[model samples]
Target: MDDGKLARMRQWMLTEIAVETACVREQIGKAQLDPQVMDVMGEVPRHVFVPAAFQAEAYLNQPVPIGCGKTISQPFIVALMTDLLDIHSTDSVLEIGTGLGYQTAVLSRLARQVYSVERLAGLAREARQRLDSLGYANIQTRVGDGYLGWPEHAPFDRIMVTAAPPQLPPALLDQLRNGGRMVLPVGPHDHQALMLVRKDAQGQSSTRVVLPVRFSALEEGEAADLF
Candidate 1:
């Protein structure tokens, strides 16, 4: 996208459509995401991550189909979750559900390290290529079940799960560092809540419901069979 075209698109987002998306605006303020997060949301070429057919509606502040029965979250939702995680420049973040890597790109800008997992090998491969082409050197993508989280890189400073689980995964809790925060969607497909979980220095954890939301169910695995 050319600089002039990008500028016009961003102007449309900040001035035109932002007001219509009430949930987006509410979440942005409630989550306390950096004002710059909105700027990044405006700047990123969301259309490129989606099918060419949907490019026209990419900046509409709504989810658009991206094939594989998956859809990228709305721009504001991405920003809200990123904000809830409270990322620091030196922190390492673990992200579940790579989807199209748009969220991964946003996280890369705020954190020192990012480890993203995608259940589908095809999606993981494609997202890796896209992020690599965009020169996001800080992001590392792996093809695997996100349910188990990434044990090899346990104790991440922050964790964000894009897909909603019936309940937060215990494995994810184990992977978070003390004092770390995690943002996730929890509940069924038809109804859900965006949640923030924090682990204190004493290893105690607590959860707070941030907003109503919905996402794809977290996949089960061999580990789940044990339950």
Candidate 2:
């Protein structure tokens, strides 16, 4: 993990996106964006979060396998969904699917605290260690069924689901505080749409599709252990 090398890669990646060579701009054209999201994206070391075998492609604006049949979402999608949250500095976020902890790191930079869940025990443990090693202290992770949501930390100010579910999970919606926002991909294997969910101040919620997306389906089951 060479810090300098990661810094270089991140810079190159941002440049690629800014120059439109990676189609990040085309993919998210004129969408609402928060400069802070871009700052976080620029700061996080994506290569270190990716599996070593895929490190070279870490900054390519594409998904790469990390294991357990999961792949981190492409950088543009991550940035788009994160910006859609409109995260506040004081907001607390619950993230479904920790994956490689890259998004967790980004969320930690914007939110007061982040609670992330992963179905696979190995990925959970590895992500926890990687995040901790990278100095992300605001992230809490657990290995379990994300559909159930983390009831102990209920009423989060925001929620983000990395995996696509056939339908919205009621528990996750319940866990979101009034006025909270959630971003996730919904639908089937062949096609899915990134959905933005907003819980109004009156406690009613609304959802709308933001963009077409593809993601591994969310799973259910008790993990082997926290490891």
Candidate 3:
């Protein structure tokens, strides 16, 4: 599709996201998402992040499959999660699941640097290439177990996990800097809730459920092949 058409579709998607946000305002505690998050959501070309066969569904306010049984998160969830993080221009963010780098792309526009970890080497490689081609120079990606939380770059100002874990991963909590925030889906594959976790200056953490959601399970242990 042409850029004009894609832009129009993206506008529709944004409208849908706004409407969805309003529908769940009570749970999320806000009627609208952060304007900055919406702006970055609008700027990122989601079509470029999905498989060629699914690009036409890129701006539908839904998740598009990116192979390996993983689906890029729904646009509303992406915006909500990113908004929950309250990312700052000077902050360093760590993303746990880099499926095609859609969320990473969004985070990259808001944070100074993004450290992303993907469990599948193939997906990590493709995501890295796509981000590079799009001129997102501040992102560094590595294929590793997302549960490990990139220890080399621990103590991140913010963290976002795309996949759902049965519970909060301990390493992720340790990596979050004091006063940092994290958003992710927590629960079994069939039943999950989008959760926002906040760590205070004293490193005590509190969590709240933002809304209901379903995401692929966060794989554990060694990296694997996407195919």
Whole-model lDDT values for every prediction: 0.82, 0.86, 0.93
lDDT of 3 at 128: 89
What is the lDDT, from 0 to 100, of the residue 213 in candidate 1? 90
| Location of the lowest summed lDDT over 10 successive residues in candidate 2 | 18-27
Better of 2 and 3 by TM-score: 3
Query: In terms of TM-score, which candidate is stronger, 1 or 2?
Result: 2
Segments of candidate 2 deviating more than 4 angstroms: 1-5, 18-32, 224-227
Ranked by lDDT, the better of candidates 1 and 2 is: 2
Q: Pick the candidate with the highest lDDT.
A: 3
Q: What is the lDDT of candidate 3?
A: 0.93
CA displacement after TM-score superposition, residue 40 of candidate 3 (Å): 0.7
lDDT of 2 at 54: 94
What does candidate 3's lDDT look like per residue over 134-163, in tens digits? Answer: 999999999999999999988899999999
On the 0 to 100 scale, the lDDT of residue 116 in model 3 is: 98
Q: Between candidates 1 and 3, name the one with more favorable lDDT.
A: 3
